[model samples]
Target: MENIEHLYEEYAQTVYKYLFSLSQNADLSEELTQETFYQAMKTIHHFRGECKISVWLCQIAKHLWYNEINKKNKTRSISIDDLEIPVHTGKNVEAAVLQNEEKLALFRMLHRLDEKTKEVMYLRLSGDLSFSEIGDILGQSETWARVTFYRGKQKMMKGRSEWNSD
Candidate 1:
């Protein structure tokens, strides 16, 4: 097997983003990201090379987050107000404000989705993984990942339309 050090350099950001998408807490994400790598290092002997390392790392992160939440026995609400939009896009002030507002609205709607669907959507959108990769990480089929994401997208669109008409 290769050095564990290289794995951190290659997959840290992806793992961090995936964990952040799940927990929506920067500090928790950071801690879990580190814990995920640590667990992987401890169990490196069991890695079968059946999937991409990134996928494996994400699976570890997912499990760690799950265990943490289950142990705490309380759901942590997503703090939309804590989300920051980057300002370097060179957009006009009005455009930036509108963009940020739209993102906030989208996130609020996303939180309304069922836990599994929301997770699929977050992994696809924020983690930037393909349906196949998501399936590997979530221990499901690619078609399942695709359909869940499609349904989630439809729910978001339907919610947005209803809001617009009200």
Candidate 2:
């Protein structure tokens, strides 16, 4: 019990941030974070200490996100207006505005991707998971994951160009 408590205390914020990045909804992210910990508590006995506790918690969060996504009855894309960009330190006001605009453009492009491509990209960028790890999570080969990422990037670039042109 103490160990589980310690694990939650140490990693809850990290797990919450991860879930928030994936879900893009504060309420839903909080719910999924709670669900992740609940599932972790139920399977605590099986933890072998081979991987970091945070990694294990992330796996739970990923599973919960996948379940929630699968259960969605409507197929819809995330809206650009819905993206939340984190503030970053900048050397100048111009740089800051440029950075924010770039981030918004990227988020808008990301929203145009299919769920699987977006999932892979998010796992790669936000989770810092390697192709093999992402493939394992998504049940695909590393090559397939790489291809999906490549295609996703191409699509994002095309979308950005079109947006800029307009």
Candidate 3:
């Protein structure tokens, strides 16, 4: 078994990013990240090593966020600012703004996808999870996760082309 502290060090950011993709709320993601670690610590012994530790941690975070949303009966929308899309252009304000706008547009398109596709994109792009890990988290096969991600990517590309033509 890995040390709890090491697991926190390695997986906290990944878990937080996953929650952020779902909640789009930094404060809530932070809370869920902490809660994820807490739960992991409590249930460490139950971990069966079937999946990567990062995958397991993200699964916990996903469950926590969903359960909270279910209890509150509220839906959270993804905002451009919520994505934390990096736009560092070495002090070029115009470049930064343009990059940010592009990211905003991309996320807006992403929001139009079905819930499962959106989740797959979030996990693949934001959480940096592999298809296998995503499948483990979503309770599907890796092929399904890969196909969903590819389909979502194609949709995003089409959306981008339409936006550009407009």
Candidate 4:
């Protein structure tokens, strides 16, 4: 078994970003990330090594997010706007703003996708996970993950064109 600190050092940001993708609240995501690690620490023995450690960690994060929702008893739209976009130090502010706007529009389109596709998109784009990894994380086949992500991209493209036409 890996030490808790090593697991945390490696996967903390990924877990936090996954939570942020689900909740769209940075502070809440951060809190939940801490909670995730705490829970993982407590249940580490139960982990059967059936999937990647990152996948296991994310699964924990997802369950905590749902429990949080159940406790609140409210629904909210999923948005990825809170995820930080890297701004090059040399880039002009206007260029950065425009880039961010483009990303925001893409994220907005993602919001309109069905929940599963949106989660796949987030896992693919934000988490930088491969299709196979996403499949393992979501308990699906790699082909399914690939197809879902492809369909989601097509829908986003169509939405973007519609927005452009309007």
Candidate 5:
């Protein structure tokens, strides 16, 4: 019990960050994070202590996230009210503008990807899961996961280039 509490306290923020990265919605991420812990508590009795607790928790979170995403075909909407366009305080106006442009470009590129590729990218980048772990999560081979990630990155780059051309 004490050990479980300590583990949760230490890893909660990391779990939340991973969840937020995957969902991109504060409310949904928070809800899913809670769900992850709930499931973890119920299943902890089965843990073999063979892997890092963080990794196990992340796996749980990833599964829950994918389940939620599949259950809802519609993309999660980002409300304008949640947008945090950083204001430049001093000499970084040009840098800030470039950063904002990059962010918009990335967002546009992401929107162009199909669901599978997007999931690969999100799990890889946001979840920080290795190719093998991603494979397990997505039910694909590690090589397939790698291929999907590379292809998705290429697609995003191509989309970004086309957007720039336009």
Candidate 6:
């Protein structure tokens, strides 16, 4: 077997990012990334090389994140009120608040979407995954993933315009 260190060096950031996308907690994601590599080392023999190594590592990270959340009895969705959007308005506190509100509204609009579209948005926006990877994960074609993401964007834009008019 090649060095596990090499594998960790190559894939740690990708696995961490995948965990972060799902958890949005840097600390938890880091811990899960380590755990993911550990688990992958243990099960490397089972990896039949059917999928990209990065994808397999992310699958491990995803499972560990879920297990961590279950242990903490936490919901997948964090409380929107507790979030602080990092949009820099500098000295303009009112502008910052408005920006945060807009981000929260976007989240709400995303939450209202159909499950498939919502998954597409989360994978595209948060996971920073490619359309092909998202399609592979979702068991759909690359074109389907691209179209779902485009449609999801359209829905969010329409919702935002409507929200602004309110």
How much does each candidate deviate from the true structure in C-alpha RMSD?
Answer: 6.2, 8.0, 6.6, 6.8, 6.3, 4.9
Model 2: per-residue Cα lDDT over 43-160, one tens digit each = 9988897766776888889899998998773666688996987566656767888887988888788888999999889977776667876675565788998999999999998888
Each model's TM-score? 0.61, 0.55, 0.60, 0.61, 0.58, 0.71
Number of the top-ranking candidate, with TM-score as the measure: 6
Where is model 6 more than 4 Å wrong at Cα? 1-3, 74-91, 129-144, 161-166
Off by over 4 Å in 2: 1-59, 63-91
lDDT of 5 at 130: 73
**Distance (Å) between predicted and true CA of 14, model 6?**
2.0
Q: Candidates 5 and 6: which is better by TM-score?
A: 6
By lDDT, is 1 or 2 better? 1
Show the lowest summed lDDT stretch of 10 residues, model 4: 82-91
lDDT of 6 by residue, 1-166 (tens): 4767898998787677667778888898888888898899899889998877777887787778778879778655678887987655567878878887878887999998999899889878898877887776666789999999999999988988997899
Model 5, span 36-122: residue lDDT tens: 888998999988977667778878988998899887767667789979887677669988888878887787787789998897888
- Order of models, best lDDT first: 4, 1, 3, 6, 2, 5
**28 in model 1: Cα distance from truth in Å?**
9.8
For model 3, the superposed segments whose C-alpha errors exceed 4 Å read 1-17, 20-34, 40-60, 66-91
**Reference-based lDDT, residue 109, model 5:** 85
Candidate 6 weakest ten by summed lDDT: 84-93
Off by over 4 Å in 1: 1-17, 20-35, 44-57, 63-91
**Candidate 4 residue lDDT tens string, 51-73:** 88988999999999999999777
lDDT tens per residue, model 1, 15-115: 88788877878899999999999999999889999877888899899899999999777766658896876656566777978988989998998999998
Estimate the TM-score for candidate 1: 0.61
